[model samples]
Target: MKTELDYLAELAGHGRISRRAFLGRAAALGVSAAMMPALAGKAFAQTAVKGGIIKAGLQGGESTNSLDPALNLSQVTFSFGKLWGEYL
Candidate 1:
């Protein structure tokens, strides 16, 4: 017997949906997640800025920012988030 949740899942069409549909469902949950940061962000107290600042010396690579986080040395590739930051 299919549970109510199962029926809902089927209505989403045989358990397969387009990226747009998946994103729609995700967007609903995303709104709540997004709101929590916006609404509750102020309830938490703020701390004073510490004196230290981080400085990375860019001896190599272009100054341009690449959205591909997985960029590596000597080849072109599709990149997504990874264990290490981007490289040449």
Candidate 2:
């Protein structure tokens, strides 16, 4: 199915899954091996840059706003700050 092909392509595109794995899955799904390269290219083209700041411009924050775990003021800030911390 196209969806399965797309999923495999996406994993390969992000380098989370190997090309061999993608091809194997694709074949098992009845996709032709000759189509692998095109699928790979499409997947790679849609991939985002590997690393960068994930910015969330949360309004209503003041200079007093703190990212400290003990001082998280709101759920949005807490979730965003948690994610940003993980990106480091």
Q: Please name the candidate that would achieve the greatest lDDT relative to the true structure.
A: 2
**Which residue segments of model 1 deviate by more than 4 Å?**
1-31, 61-88
lDDT of each: 0.40, 0.75
TM-score of 2: 0.45
Candidate 2 all-Cα RMSD: 9.8
Candidate 2 per-residue lDDT, tens place, 1-88, comes to: 8887778877887889876787788888887778778888855444345677577776666677677778887776687678867833
Q: Write model 1 residue lDDT over 8-66, tens digit each, in one string.
A: 33434443544345335545544443443342233333465545443444444454546
Q: Taking the candidates one at a time, how many backbone clashes does each contain?
A: 0, 0
